[model samples]
Target chain A: MTSKWFLKSTGTAAALSSLVLFLYANLRQPTLTEQMLPVHLKIFELDRTPQAHEQQAVLAVLKQQLGVTAVSFSQEGKTFSVTYCPDKITAEKLRAAASLNEAFKVSEKTFPPSPACPVPPLDEVKHKVLGVLRIF
Target chain B: MRKFVLYFVLALAVGMSLTACNDDKVLYEIDPNSLYSRLGGFDAISAVTDQFLANVAADNVINARFAATVANPARLQLLRNNLVDQICEAAGGPCRYKGLNMRAAHTGMNITEQEFNALVADLVAALNRFNVPEKEKNELLGILGPMKPDIVGR
Candidate 1:
Protein backbone atom coordinates (compact mmCIF):
# COMPACT_ATOMS: atom_id res chain seq x y z
CA MET A 1 0.00 0.00 0.00
CA THR A 2 2.85 2.45 0.83
CA SER A 3 4.64 1.78 -2.47
CA LYS A 4 1.35 2.08 -4.38
CA TRP A 5 0.68 5.59 -2.98
CA PHE A 6 4.22 6.74 -3.81
CA LEU A 7 3.95 5.44 -7.38
CA LYS A 8 0.54 7.03 -7.91
CA SER A 9 1.74 10.41 -6.61
CA THR A 10 4.88 10.28 -8.81
CA GLY A 11 2.76 9.42 -11.88
CA THR A 12 0.42 12.32 -11.20
CA ALA A 13 3.38 14.71 -10.82
CA ALA A 14 4.88 13.49 -14.09
CA ALA A 15 1.61 13.98 -15.98
CA LEU A 16 1.20 17.55 -14.64
CA SER A 17 4.79 18.43 -15.54
CA SER A 18 4.28 17.13 -19.08
CA LEU A 19 1.09 19.14 -19.51
CA VAL A 20 2.75 22.38 -18.30
CA LEU A 21 5.79 21.76 -20.47
CA PHE A 22 3.62 21.25 -23.54
CA LEU A 23 1.71 24.51 -22.91
CA TYR A 24 4.91 26.48 -22.37
CA ALA A 25 6.56 25.09 -25.46
CA ASN A 26 3.57 25.97 -27.56
CA LEU A 27 2.73 29.46 -26.17
CA ARG A 28 5.88 31.14 -24.94
CA GLN A 29 6.42 34.78 -26.02
CA PRO A 30 8.58 35.30 -29.05
CA THR A 31 11.99 36.90 -28.52
CA LEU A 32 12.36 40.59 -29.25
CA THR A 33 14.87 41.77 -31.85
CA GLU A 34 15.90 45.14 -33.24
CA GLN A 35 14.64 44.17 -36.66
CA MET A 36 11.20 43.63 -35.16
CA LEU A 37 11.08 47.20 -33.84
CA PRO A 38 9.76 50.34 -35.51
CA VAL A 39 12.08 52.46 -33.42
CA HIS A 40 14.64 53.96 -35.78
CA LEU A 41 14.56 57.68 -36.53
CA LYS A 42 16.76 59.72 -38.87
CA ILE A 43 16.97 63.46 -39.31
CA PHE A 44 17.51 64.88 -42.80
CA GLU A 45 18.55 68.44 -43.48
CA LEU A 46 17.15 70.15 -46.54
CA ASP A 47 19.32 73.00 -47.73
CA ARG A 48 17.33 75.81 -49.25
CA THR A 49 14.66 74.87 -46.74
CA PRO A 50 11.29 75.35 -48.33
CA GLN A 51 8.78 77.92 -47.26
CA ALA A 52 5.24 77.04 -46.16
CA HIS A 53 3.91 76.10 -49.57
CA GLU A 54 7.17 74.44 -50.55
CA GLN A 55 7.30 72.63 -47.23
CA GLN A 56 3.95 71.05 -48.03
CA ALA A 57 5.37 70.04 -51.39
CA VAL A 58 8.48 68.51 -49.81
CA LEU A 59 6.49 66.77 -47.10
CA ALA A 60 4.15 65.35 -49.68
CA VAL A 61 7.04 63.94 -51.69
CA LEU A 62 8.66 62.43 -48.62
CA LYS A 63 5.43 60.82 -47.42
CA GLN A 64 5.02 59.16 -50.78
CA GLN A 65 8.33 57.32 -50.65
CA LEU A 66 8.44 53.52 -50.08
CA GLY A 67 9.84 53.01 -46.61
CA VAL A 68 9.22 56.36 -44.94
CA THR A 69 6.83 55.69 -42.08
CA ALA A 70 6.54 59.27 -40.71
CA VAL A 71 7.71 62.78 -41.53
CA SER A 72 7.90 65.92 -39.43
CA PHE A 73 9.44 69.34 -39.97
CA SER A 74 11.29 71.05 -37.19
CA GLN A 75 9.92 74.31 -35.78
CA GLU A 76 12.37 76.36 -37.82
CA GLY A 77 11.25 74.40 -40.90
CA LYS A 78 14.78 73.70 -42.10
CA THR A 79 15.22 70.09 -40.98
CA PHE A 80 12.87 67.11 -41.24
CA SER A 81 12.80 63.95 -39.12
CA VAL A 82 11.92 60.68 -40.80
CA THR A 83 10.97 57.33 -39.32
CA TYR A 84 11.52 54.45 -41.69
CA CYS A 85 11.96 50.72 -41.99
CA PRO A 86 15.70 50.11 -42.17
CA ASP A 87 14.83 46.82 -43.82
CA LYS A 88 12.92 48.49 -46.66
CA ILE A 89 15.49 51.05 -47.80
CA THR A 90 18.91 52.56 -47.15
CA ALA A 91 19.47 56.10 -45.87
CA GLU A 92 21.24 57.14 -49.07
CA LYS A 93 18.27 56.07 -51.14
CA LEU A 94 15.96 57.99 -48.83
CA ARG A 95 18.18 61.04 -49.12
CA ALA A 96 18.00 60.83 -52.90
CA ALA A 97 14.27 60.40 -52.74
CA ALA A 98 14.07 63.58 -50.68
CA SER A 99 15.74 65.60 -53.44
CA LEU A 100 13.17 64.73 -56.07
CA ASN A 101 11.81 68.25 -56.50
CA GLU A 102 15.26 69.71 -57.08
CA ALA A 103 15.14 71.06 -53.59
CA PHE A 104 18.27 73.16 -53.02
CA LYS A 105 19.96 70.48 -50.91
CA VAL A 106 19.33 67.25 -49.05
CA SER A 107 21.63 65.71 -46.48
CA GLU A 108 21.50 63.76 -43.24
CA LYS A 109 22.07 66.03 -40.27
CA THR A 110 24.29 64.76 -37.45
CA PHE A 111 23.86 65.85 -33.91
CA PRO A 112 26.82 66.95 -31.85
CA PRO A 113 27.95 64.43 -29.29
CA SER A 114 26.66 65.08 -25.81
CA PRO A 115 29.55 64.97 -23.42
CA ALA A 116 27.35 65.10 -20.34
CA CYS A 117 24.71 62.58 -21.29
CA PRO A 118 25.62 59.75 -23.58
CA VAL A 119 23.02 57.83 -25.55
CA PRO A 120 23.06 54.29 -26.92
CA PRO A 121 23.49 53.91 -30.68
CA LEU A 122 20.77 51.33 -31.27
CA ASP A 123 17.80 49.46 -29.70
CA GLU A 124 19.77 46.20 -29.86
CA VAL A 125 20.95 46.56 -26.29
CA LYS A 126 17.42 46.87 -24.92
CA HIS A 127 16.20 43.96 -27.03
CA LYS A 128 19.13 41.83 -25.96
CA VAL A 129 18.53 42.55 -22.28
CA LEU A 130 14.77 42.01 -22.41
CA GLY A 131 15.24 38.87 -24.51
CA VAL A 132 16.50 36.95 -21.52
CA LEU A 133 13.56 37.71 -19.23
CA ARG A 134 11.37 34.59 -19.51
CA ILE A 135 8.34 35.08 -17.27
CA PHE A 136 6.84 31.65 -17.77
CA MET B 1 -10.73 130.32 -55.98
CA ARG B 2 -11.32 128.83 -52.49
CA LYS B 3 -13.61 126.18 -53.95
CA PHE B 4 -10.90 125.23 -56.48
CA VAL B 5 -8.34 124.81 -53.64
CA LEU B 6 -10.72 122.55 -51.67
CA TYR B 7 -11.28 120.31 -54.70
CA PHE B 8 -7.54 119.97 -55.29
CA VAL B 9 -6.87 119.13 -51.62
CA LEU B 10 -9.55 116.38 -51.68
CA ALA B 11 -8.07 114.94 -54.84
CA LEU B 12 -4.61 114.81 -53.24
CA ALA B 13 -5.93 112.95 -50.16
CA VAL B 14 -7.56 110.30 -52.35
CA GLY B 15 -4.34 109.94 -54.35
CA MET B 16 -2.36 109.41 -51.14
CA SER B 17 -4.81 106.76 -49.94
CA LEU B 18 -4.52 104.85 -53.23
CA THR B 19 -0.71 104.98 -52.99
CA ALA B 20 -0.82 103.57 -49.46
CA CYS B 21 -2.68 100.43 -50.58
CA ASN B 22 0.04 99.47 -53.07
CA ASP B 23 2.65 98.86 -50.33
CA ASP B 24 0.76 95.96 -48.72
CA LYS B 25 1.65 93.66 -51.64
CA VAL B 26 5.23 93.59 -50.40
CA LEU B 27 4.16 92.45 -46.93
CA TYR B 28 1.59 89.78 -47.79
CA GLU B 29 2.94 88.23 -50.97
CA ILE B 30 4.33 84.74 -50.36
CA ASP B 31 6.67 83.38 -52.98
CA PRO B 32 5.82 79.73 -53.58
CA ASN B 33 9.04 79.13 -55.43
CA SER B 34 12.12 78.31 -53.33
CA LEU B 35 15.77 78.09 -54.25
CA TYR B 36 15.54 74.58 -52.88
CA SER B 37 13.25 73.69 -55.70
CA ARG B 38 15.38 75.59 -58.19
CA LEU B 39 18.51 73.69 -57.13
CA GLY B 40 16.88 70.37 -57.97
CA GLY B 41 15.88 69.59 -54.40
CA PHE B 42 17.54 66.85 -52.40
CA ASP B 43 19.17 65.22 -55.40
CA ALA B 44 21.35 68.17 -56.27
CA ILE B 45 22.00 68.95 -52.65
CA SER B 46 23.42 65.52 -51.91
CA ALA B 47 25.40 65.65 -55.09
CA VAL B 48 26.87 68.97 -54.14
CA THR B 49 27.69 67.59 -50.74
CA ASP B 50 29.57 64.64 -52.20
CA GLN B 51 31.38 66.82 -54.69
CA PHE B 52 32.23 69.30 -51.96
CA LEU B 53 33.64 66.57 -49.75
CA ALA B 54 35.69 65.20 -52.62
CA ASN B 55 36.96 68.68 -53.37
CA VAL B 56 37.83 69.10 -49.74
CA ALA B 57 39.72 65.83 -49.78
CA ALA B 58 41.68 66.82 -52.87
CA ASP B 59 42.35 70.44 -51.97
CA ASN B 60 45.44 70.99 -49.89
CA VAL B 61 44.26 74.36 -48.67
CA ILE B 62 41.36 73.12 -46.58
CA ASN B 63 42.06 69.37 -46.40
CA ALA B 64 44.34 69.91 -43.42
CA ARG B 65 41.51 71.65 -41.58
CA PHE B 66 39.57 68.43 -41.99
CA ALA B 67 42.48 66.09 -41.22
CA ALA B 68 40.89 64.65 -38.11
CA THR B 69 37.57 64.24 -39.88
CA VAL B 70 39.17 62.48 -42.85
CA ALA B 71 41.05 60.13 -40.62
CA ASN B 72 37.88 58.83 -39.03
CA PRO B 73 35.10 57.64 -41.33
CA ALA B 74 32.36 58.19 -38.76
CA ARG B 75 33.67 61.64 -37.95
CA LEU B 76 33.97 62.45 -41.63
CA GLN B 77 30.36 61.44 -42.18
CA LEU B 78 29.21 63.48 -39.20
CA LEU B 79 31.04 66.50 -40.53
CA ARG B 80 29.33 65.94 -43.87
CA ASN B 81 25.96 65.74 -42.15
CA ASN B 82 26.62 68.95 -40.27
CA LEU B 83 27.62 70.74 -43.46
CA VAL B 84 24.53 69.55 -45.33
CA ASP B 85 22.32 70.62 -42.46
CA GLN B 86 23.91 74.03 -42.42
CA ILE B 87 23.22 74.45 -46.11
CA CYS B 88 19.70 73.08 -45.85
CA GLU B 89 18.82 75.21 -42.86
CA ALA B 90 20.49 78.41 -44.02
CA ALA B 91 18.70 78.53 -47.35
CA GLY B 92 15.36 78.70 -45.58
CA GLY B 93 14.59 75.03 -46.14
CA PRO B 94 12.46 72.86 -43.85
CA CYS B 95 15.12 71.79 -41.37
CA ARG B 96 15.97 73.43 -38.07
CA TYR B 97 19.65 72.61 -37.62
CA LYS B 98 20.07 70.95 -34.24
CA GLY B 99 23.86 71.07 -34.13
CA LEU B 100 25.89 73.54 -32.12
CA ASN B 101 25.71 77.09 -33.44
CA MET B 102 28.64 78.02 -35.66
CA ARG B 103 30.23 80.43 -33.22
CA ALA B 104 29.90 78.12 -30.27
CA ALA B 105 31.02 75.05 -32.18
CA HIS B 106 34.03 76.83 -33.63
CA THR B 107 34.91 78.79 -30.49
CA GLY B 108 37.88 76.69 -29.56
CA MET B 109 38.63 75.31 -33.02
CA ASN B 110 40.19 78.67 -33.97
CA ILE B 111 39.47 78.20 -37.66
CA THR B 112 41.17 81.02 -39.57
CA GLU B 113 39.66 83.35 -42.14
CA GLN B 114 41.88 81.79 -44.82
CA GLU B 115 40.70 78.31 -43.98
CA PHE B 116 37.12 79.55 -44.03
CA ASN B 117 37.59 81.08 -47.47
CA ALA B 118 39.22 77.90 -48.71
CA LEU B 119 36.28 75.90 -47.49
CA VAL B 120 33.93 78.21 -49.34
CA ALA B 121 35.96 77.85 -52.50
CA ASP B 122 35.80 74.10 -52.13
CA LEU B 123 32.04 74.32 -51.77
CA VAL B 124 31.81 76.68 -54.73
CA ALA B 125 33.83 74.25 -56.78
CA ALA B 126 31.43 71.49 -55.86
CA LEU B 127 28.47 73.71 -56.70
CA ASN B 128 29.99 74.51 -60.04
CA ARG B 129 30.84 70.88 -60.71
CA PHE B 130 27.12 70.16 -60.95
CA ASN B 131 26.67 73.21 -63.17
CA VAL B 132 24.38 75.01 -60.77
CA PRO B 133 23.16 78.20 -62.41
CA GLU B 134 24.61 81.54 -61.36
CA LYS B 135 21.40 82.82 -59.81
CA GLU B 136 20.78 79.76 -57.66
CA LYS B 137 24.44 79.41 -56.77
CA ASN B 138 24.73 83.06 -55.79
CA GLU B 139 21.49 82.92 -53.85
CA LEU B 140 22.61 79.87 -51.92
CA LEU B 141 26.00 81.39 -51.26
CA GLY B 142 24.51 84.72 -50.30
CA ILE B 143 22.45 82.98 -47.68
CA LEU B 144 25.40 80.95 -46.39
CA GLY B 145 28.12 83.59 -46.77
CA PRO B 146 27.03 85.59 -43.75
CA MET B 147 27.81 82.55 -41.64
CA LYS B 148 31.48 83.35 -42.12
CA PRO B 149 31.47 85.70 -39.14
CA ASP B 150 30.31 82.95 -36.86
CA ILE B 151 32.68 80.34 -38.33
CA VAL B 152 35.94 82.23 -38.75
CA GLY B 153 36.96 82.51 -35.11
CA ARG B 154 35.90 82.20 -31.52
Candidate 2:
Protein backbone atom coordinates (compact mmCIF):
# COMPACT_ATOMS: atom_id res chain seq x y z
CA MET A 1 0.00 0.00 0.00
CA THR A 2 2.82 2.43 0.85
CA SER A 3 4.64 1.64 -2.44
CA LYS A 4 1.45 2.30 -4.36
CA TRP A 5 0.99 5.67 -2.62
CA PHE A 6 4.61 6.71 -3.38
CA LEU A 7 4.17 5.76 -7.03
CA LYS A 8 0.98 7.79 -7.17
CA SER A 9 2.66 10.83 -5.59
CA THR A 10 5.57 10.78 -8.02
CA GLY A 11 3.22 10.42 -10.98
CA THR A 12 1.15 13.34 -9.69
CA ALA A 13 4.30 15.48 -9.38
CA ALA A 14 5.33 14.66 -12.96
CA ALA A 15 1.83 15.56 -14.15
CA LEU A 16 1.91 18.97 -12.42
CA SER A 17 5.38 19.72 -13.87
CA SER A 18 4.21 18.87 -17.38
CA LEU A 19 1.08 20.96 -16.95
CA VAL A 20 3.14 24.01 -15.89
CA LEU A 21 5.49 23.54 -18.82
CA PHE A 22 2.63 23.29 -21.27
CA LEU A 23 0.99 26.45 -19.89
CA TYR A 24 4.27 28.37 -20.05
CA ALA A 25 4.91 27.24 -23.61
CA ASN A 26 1.44 28.19 -24.75
CA LEU A 27 1.90 31.66 -23.24
CA ARG A 28 5.33 32.16 -24.83
CA GLN A 29 5.46 34.24 -28.00
CA PRO A 30 6.63 32.75 -31.29
CA THR A 31 9.57 34.22 -33.11
CA LEU A 32 8.55 35.94 -36.34
CA THR A 33 11.34 38.18 -37.62
CA GLU A 34 14.45 36.75 -39.31
CA GLN A 35 17.73 38.52 -40.03
CA MET A 36 19.14 38.71 -43.55
CA LEU A 37 22.64 39.47 -44.80
CA PRO A 38 23.52 41.58 -47.83
CA VAL A 39 24.09 39.71 -51.11
CA HIS A 40 27.57 39.53 -52.67
CA LEU A 41 28.41 39.81 -56.38
CA LYS A 42 31.46 37.92 -57.64
CA ILE A 43 33.61 39.07 -60.59
CA PHE A 44 35.79 36.35 -62.06
CA GLU A 45 38.92 36.07 -64.27
CA LEU A 46 40.85 39.16 -63.17
CA ASP A 47 44.59 38.98 -63.83
CA ARG A 48 46.56 37.31 -61.03
CA THR A 49 50.13 37.58 -62.28
CA PRO A 50 52.78 39.28 -60.10
CA GLN A 51 52.41 42.43 -62.17
CA ALA A 52 48.76 42.61 -61.09
CA HIS A 53 48.90 46.26 -59.98
CA GLU A 54 46.81 47.05 -63.03
CA GLN A 55 44.24 44.54 -61.79
CA GLN A 56 44.22 46.23 -58.38
CA ALA A 57 43.70 49.65 -60.01
CA VAL A 58 40.75 48.25 -61.97
CA LEU A 59 39.25 46.83 -58.80
CA ALA A 60 39.60 50.24 -57.11
CA VAL A 61 37.77 51.85 -59.99
CA LEU A 62 35.01 49.24 -59.69
CA LYS A 63 34.71 49.80 -55.96
CA GLN A 64 34.45 53.55 -56.45
CA GLN A 65 31.94 53.38 -59.30
CA LEU A 66 29.77 50.72 -57.69
CA GLY A 67 29.76 52.19 -54.18
CA VAL A 68 30.87 48.96 -52.57
CA THR A 69 32.31 49.26 -49.06
CA ALA A 70 34.23 45.96 -48.85
CA VAL A 71 36.33 44.43 -51.63
CA SER A 72 38.09 41.07 -51.45
CA PHE A 73 40.76 40.26 -54.02
CA SER A 74 42.23 36.77 -54.27
CA GLN A 75 44.13 34.70 -56.81
CA GLU A 76 43.86 31.12 -57.97
CA GLY A 77 46.24 30.21 -60.78
CA LYS A 78 45.95 32.91 -63.46
CA THR A 79 42.60 34.30 -62.31
CA PHE A 80 41.51 36.65 -59.52
CA SER A 81 38.16 37.02 -57.72
CA VAL A 82 36.56 40.28 -56.71
CA THR A 83 33.55 39.86 -54.36
CA TYR A 84 31.46 42.92 -53.59
CA CYS A 85 27.94 43.81 -52.48
CA PRO A 86 25.34 43.14 -55.19
CA ASP A 87 23.01 45.75 -53.74
CA LYS A 88 25.50 48.48 -54.55
CA ILE A 89 27.42 47.26 -57.63
CA THR A 90 26.66 44.75 -60.33
CA ALA A 91 28.81 42.04 -61.92
CA GLU A 92 28.32 43.68 -65.34
CA LYS A 93 29.94 46.90 -64.15
CA LEU A 94 32.96 44.89 -63.12
CA ARG A 95 33.07 43.24 -66.55
CA ALA A 96 32.80 46.61 -68.32
CA ALA A 97 35.64 47.98 -66.22
CA ALA A 98 37.73 44.95 -67.16
CA SER A 99 36.84 45.35 -70.83
CA LEU A 100 37.94 48.99 -70.81
CA ASN A 101 41.26 48.09 -69.14
CA GLU A 102 41.92 45.11 -71.48
CA ALA A 103 43.58 43.39 -68.51
CA PHE A 104 40.69 41.36 -67.11
CA LYS A 105 37.85 39.17 -68.35
CA VAL A 106 34.66 39.16 -66.31
CA SER A 107 32.39 36.13 -66.22
CA GLU A 108 29.42 35.73 -63.92
CA LYS A 109 27.71 32.83 -62.22
CA THR A 110 24.59 33.19 -60.11
CA PHE A 111 24.80 31.49 -56.75
CA PRO A 112 21.82 29.82 -55.18
CA PRO A 113 19.94 32.31 -53.10
CA SER A 114 21.66 32.71 -49.74
CA PRO A 115 20.26 31.30 -46.51
CA ALA A 116 19.46 34.86 -45.55
CA CYS A 117 16.80 34.83 -48.24
CA PRO A 118 13.71 32.91 -47.17
CA VAL A 119 13.63 29.41 -48.54
CA PRO A 120 11.95 29.21 -51.94
CA PRO A 121 8.63 27.45 -51.95
CA LEU A 122 9.14 23.74 -51.90
CA ASP A 123 8.31 21.65 -54.93
CA GLU A 124 6.29 18.43 -54.82
CA VAL A 125 9.28 16.31 -53.78
CA LYS A 126 10.06 18.69 -50.96
CA HIS A 127 6.46 18.73 -49.95
CA LYS A 128 6.52 14.93 -49.75
CA VAL A 129 9.68 15.01 -47.67
CA LEU A 130 8.13 17.48 -45.25
CA GLY A 131 5.03 15.34 -45.12
CA VAL A 132 7.07 12.27 -44.22
CA LEU A 133 8.76 14.23 -41.47
CA ARG A 134 5.30 15.35 -40.24
CA ILE A 135 6.48 18.94 -40.73
CA PHE A 136 3.54 20.08 -42.80
CA MET B 1 -4.80 9.00 -10.36
CA ARG B 2 -1.52 7.66 -11.76
CA LYS B 3 -3.18 6.72 -15.02
CA PHE B 4 -4.62 10.28 -15.34
CA VAL B 5 -1.16 11.81 -14.76
CA LEU B 6 0.46 9.54 -17.34
CA TYR B 7 -2.12 10.46 -19.96
CA PHE B 8 -1.72 14.18 -19.25
CA VAL B 9 2.07 14.00 -19.75
CA LEU B 10 1.65 12.14 -23.04
CA ALA B 11 -0.88 14.71 -24.23
CA LEU B 12 1.51 17.56 -23.37
CA ALA B 13 4.32 15.96 -25.34
CA VAL B 14 2.13 15.58 -28.41
CA GLY B 15 0.96 19.18 -28.16
CA MET B 16 4.53 20.50 -28.02
CA SER B 17 5.55 18.41 -31.01
CA LEU B 18 2.63 19.67 -33.07
CA THR B 19 3.48 23.27 -32.22
CA ALA B 20 7.06 22.75 -33.31
CA CYS B 21 5.86 21.54 -36.70
CA ASN B 22 3.97 24.74 -37.43
CA ASP B 23 7.15 26.66 -38.18
CA ASP B 24 7.70 24.80 -41.44
CA LYS B 25 4.74 26.36 -43.24
CA VAL B 26 5.40 27.76 -46.72
CA LEU B 27 5.32 31.56 -46.84
CA TYR B 28 5.41 32.60 -50.52
CA GLU B 29 6.90 31.95 -53.95
CA ILE B 30 8.89 34.27 -56.17
CA ASP B 31 6.79 35.36 -59.09
CA PRO B 32 7.67 33.60 -62.36
CA ASN B 33 7.19 36.85 -64.33
CA SER B 34 9.56 38.84 -62.17
CA LEU B 35 12.50 38.55 -64.59
CA TYR B 36 10.54 40.19 -67.42
CA SER B 37 9.36 43.07 -65.25
CA ARG B 38 12.77 43.53 -63.70
CA LEU B 39 14.53 43.70 -67.09
CA GLY B 40 12.38 46.75 -67.89
CA GLY B 41 10.46 44.70 -70.45
CA PHE B 42 10.49 45.62 -74.18
CA ASP B 43 11.01 49.37 -74.14
CA ALA B 44 13.85 49.45 -71.69
CA ILE B 45 15.65 46.67 -73.53
CA SER B 46 15.44 48.63 -76.81
CA ALA B 47 16.70 51.81 -75.17
CA VAL B 48 19.62 50.02 -73.58
CA THR B 49 20.39 48.24 -76.83
CA ASP B 50 20.50 51.55 -78.69
CA GLN B 51 22.98 52.90 -76.17
CA PHE B 52 25.00 49.68 -76.42
CA LEU B 53 25.19 49.92 -80.22
CA ALA B 54 26.43 53.52 -79.94
CA ASN B 55 29.09 52.39 -77.45
CA VAL B 56 30.12 49.56 -79.76
CA ALA B 57 30.42 52.02 -82.68
CA ALA B 58 33.06 53.93 -80.68
CA ASP B 59 34.99 50.81 -79.46
CA ASN B 60 38.16 50.62 -81.57
CA VAL B 61 38.49 46.85 -81.75
CA ILE B 62 35.09 46.07 -83.29
CA ASN B 63 33.73 49.51 -84.18
CA ALA B 64 34.33 49.42 -87.92
CA ARG B 65 32.28 46.30 -88.47
CA PHE B 66 29.64 47.16 -85.86
CA ALA B 67 29.10 50.67 -87.25
CA ALA B 68 28.00 49.29 -90.63
CA THR B 69 25.07 47.25 -89.30
CA VAL B 70 24.20 49.31 -86.19
CA ALA B 71 23.09 52.30 -88.25
CA ASN B 72 19.68 50.68 -88.76
CA PRO B 73 17.78 51.39 -85.52
CA ALA B 74 14.72 49.35 -86.58
CA ARG B 75 16.85 46.26 -87.23
CA LEU B 76 18.71 46.72 -83.96
CA GLN B 77 15.44 47.16 -82.07
CA LEU B 78 14.06 43.95 -83.53
CA LEU B 79 17.26 42.11 -82.56
CA ARG B 80 17.07 43.56 -79.06
CA ASN B 81 13.47 42.40 -78.68
CA ASN B 82 14.40 38.91 -79.79
CA LEU B 83 17.35 38.83 -77.41
CA VAL B 84 15.24 40.01 -74.48
CA ASP B 85 12.53 37.49 -75.26
CA GLN B 86 15.07 34.66 -75.36
CA ILE B 87 16.53 35.78 -72.06
CA CYS B 88 13.14 36.17 -70.43
CA GLU B 89 11.86 32.80 -71.60
CA ALA B 90 15.02 31.02 -70.51
CA ALA B 91 14.70 32.55 -67.02
CA GLY B 92 11.24 30.91 -66.48
CA GLY B 93 9.47 34.08 -67.51
CA PRO B 94 6.57 34.33 -70.01
CA CYS B 95 8.10 35.63 -73.21
CA ARG B 96 8.24 33.72 -76.51
CA TYR B 97 11.32 34.40 -78.62
CA LYS B 98 10.73 34.48 -82.37
CA GLY B 99 14.28 35.00 -83.63
CA LEU B 100 16.27 32.84 -86.02
CA ASN B 101 18.80 30.41 -84.63
CA MET B 102 22.12 32.09 -83.75
CA ARG B 103 24.14 30.50 -86.55
CA ALA B 104 21.74 31.47 -89.34
CA ALA B 105 21.17 34.97 -87.98
CA HIS B 106 24.90 35.85 -87.71
CA THR B 107 26.09 33.94 -90.80
CA GLY B 108 28.42 35.71 -93.27
CA MET B 109 28.64 38.71 -90.95
CA ASN B 110 32.39 38.01 -90.66
CA ILE B 111 31.98 38.62 -86.92
CA THR B 112 35.29 37.43 -85.51
CA GLU B 113 35.51 35.88 -82.07
CA GLN B 114 37.17 39.06 -80.75
CA GLU B 115 34.36 41.24 -82.11
CA PHE B 116 31.76 38.88 -80.65
CA ASN B 117 33.46 39.11 -77.27
CA ALA B 118 33.64 42.90 -77.55
CA LEU B 119 29.91 43.04 -78.24
CA VAL B 120 29.30 40.99 -75.11
CA ALA B 121 31.44 43.40 -73.09
CA ASP B 122 29.54 46.39 -74.46
CA LEU B 123 26.19 44.78 -73.70
CA VAL B 124 27.32 44.06 -70.15
CA ALA B 125 28.18 47.72 -69.68
CA ALA B 126 24.83 48.78 -71.08
CA LEU B 127 22.92 46.41 -68.82
CA ASN B 128 24.92 47.60 -65.84
CA ARG B 129 24.14 51.21 -66.60
CA PHE B 130 20.47 50.27 -66.65
CA ASN B 131 20.80 48.67 -63.17
CA VAL B 132 20.06 45.06 -64.14
CA PRO B 133 20.72 42.70 -61.23
CA GLU B 134 23.55 40.19 -61.40
CA LYS B 135 21.35 37.10 -61.60
CA GLU B 136 19.21 38.52 -64.37
CA LYS B 137 22.28 39.72 -66.20
CA ASN B 138 23.78 36.25 -66.05
CA GLU B 139 20.54 34.67 -67.15
CA LEU B 140 20.50 37.02 -70.12
CA LEU B 141 24.16 36.32 -70.90
CA GLY B 142 23.78 32.59 -70.59
CA ILE B 143 21.27 32.72 -73.40
CA LEU B 144 23.52 35.08 -75.36
CA GLY B 145 26.82 33.23 -74.82
CA PRO B 146 25.63 29.91 -76.19
CA MET B 147 25.20 31.73 -79.50
CA LYS B 148 28.97 32.33 -79.70
CA PRO B 149 29.18 29.07 -81.60
CA ASP B 150 27.17 30.60 -84.44
CA ILE B 151 28.12 34.24 -83.92
CA VAL B 152 31.92 33.64 -83.92
CA GLY B 153 31.83 30.77 -86.47
CA ARG B 154 35.64 30.50 -86.31
Please report the candidate that would top lDDT against the real structure: 1
Off by over 4 Å in 2: A1-136, B1-34, B91-94
What docking grade does candidate 1 earn? incorrect
Compute the lDDT of residue B39 as modeled in candidate 1. Answer: 80
Candidate 1 chain B least-lDDT 10 residues: B22-31
Please, what are the lDDT tens digits per residue for candidate 1 over residues A1-136? 9999999888766754444444433334332111132323455677875789888877787678776655656546776655555678667777777776565588766544322111123432433333344234
Candidate 2 TM-score versus the reference: 0.38
Number of clashing residue pairs in every model?
22, 0
**Strongest candidate by DockQ:** 2
Model 1 steric clash total: 22
| Candidate 2: RMSD to truth | 20.9
Off by over 4 Å in 1: A1-136, B1-32
Q: Write down the TM-score of every candidate.
A: 0.43, 0.38
Q: Lowest summed lDDT over 10 consecutive residues: which window, candidate 1 chain A? A: A30-39
Which clashing pairs does model 2 show? none
